[model samples]
Target: MLEFVVCFTVVAILGGLLLQRLWHYRAEAERAAVQMVIANIRSALEIKVAQANLPDGSLDFTFLTEENPLNLLKVKPVNYAGEWYRPSGADIGAGNWCFDRADKTLLYLLNNVNSFEDSQTKLLKFKVKLTRLPHSPAKPSGAPETLGVAFEQVKD
Candidate 1:
């Protein structure tokens, strides 16, 4: 009778521990997913930069405009006619991107630009950013092998 009671107690404790671990993992997975989305955005930009083979070997600002020679590399058209991006059903496509020429501090307009802690947290977050260099490399082959190292620091 004593052994039976001890076994039940052990099982109950183990079950509680498992449930706790599962809950913690669920939250962590969600955070990781959000991070992945941010990471992908950076990677896609790098891919495009690589496609634009510059004369001096660095990605030029000219590649960013409508006259971008590597238009085929863009998922979302680099040069559109007269239309901004259409919003997805759940605001997935609603994002803004801008660059500061003076400071070179590119500002990615995120959907949920929270100022510290706020009560209004959404189900998902959207964001974008600019990746640039000091003076543009003398030659940028735009190779994945070349750009992969820059992003590796941010990935899990």
Candidate 2:
């Protein structure tokens, strides 16, 4: 009887530890998925900038900031919930992407909130901003300055 009880307790403890490890892994996977989406968005933004630069020697970055960055992508992620103005938590839900038009920020509501560290609100917010590279000495004086796009994390 004593041996049976000890074996049961060991099995129970092991089961609990296994469950905790699984949750940690699930949170890590969620973080990776979010990063992948952000990377795709960044690539799309770069393509848009290049396309714009081809047409004009001077690029106006003001419009880019106000525009929805997701629109630049040829195909958005399946999890994307689309754009919203002043979206509430219930409206956005977890494991979804939403663009908050009110502040021109993209929001990702995390489903695995246990280990997500980007925000305390269990949401990750990002903003697209224009980036300018320093003038290169090798470039000709008349050459247009290099411009790029940056995906910056925003605190909510």
Candidate 3:
């Protein structure tokens, strides 16, 4: 009886440990996925800005969300895997990132949906900043514009 009880306890403890490890791995995977989505969106935006030839050689805030300005950028809409990524604050069902063009900076929010409970392991909230640095535009030679991109995880 003693042997049987001890064996059962050991197995239970091992199972619990395995479950905890798996949960940690799952959270890390979610964070990586969110970061990759944000990176792709940023790349697309940079390409769009370079092709647009803005009068001031900087990204116009309106191009981030407004359809009219977006069309003029000549960059394909953000697409990943087999789905199309829509604008932020739109139906988030098919998208993982949201775009916010506030004042002078552009913001990309990764994993914008907060579906996890307070007690549950939550995905990281990545806030990517896109700032247009001040520089003189190259005269008519079509040099690509320079923009600064930075990212930080927001703690809730």
TM-score of model 2 vs. true structure: 0.84
Q: Which clashing pairs does model 1 show?
A: 50-142, 56-138, 57-139, 57-140
Best by the lDDT measure: 2
Q: How many clashes does the backbone of model 2 have?
A: 0
TM-score of each model, in listed order = 0.39, 0.84, 0.49
Q: Mind sharing the TM-score for model 1? A: 0.39
Model 3 CA lDDT for position 58: 49
Report lDDT (Cα) of residue 115, candidate 3: 27
Root-mean-square deviation (CA) per prediction: 10.9, 2.4, 8.4
Worst 10 residues of 2 by lDDT: 112-121
Score residue 65 of candidate 2 by CA lDDT: 90
User: lDDT at 15 for candidate 2?
Assistant: 100
Report the lDDT tens digits of candidate 1 across residue range 29-102: 54454454446655665665665555555644343433222133334333112222333323333233332332
**How big is the positional error of residue 12 in model 3, measured in Å on the Cα after superposition?**
0.5
Task: Give candidate 1 misplaced runs (Cα > 4 Å).
Answer: 1-3, 53-124, 130-156
Per-residue alpha-carbon lDDT of candidate 2 for residues 1-156, written as tens digits (9 for 90 to 100): 999999999999999999999989998988888888889888887777777788664477678799888888888888888899989878888999999999999998889776567467788899998788899889999997787778888874
Identify the superior model by lDDT, candidate 1 or candidate 3: 3
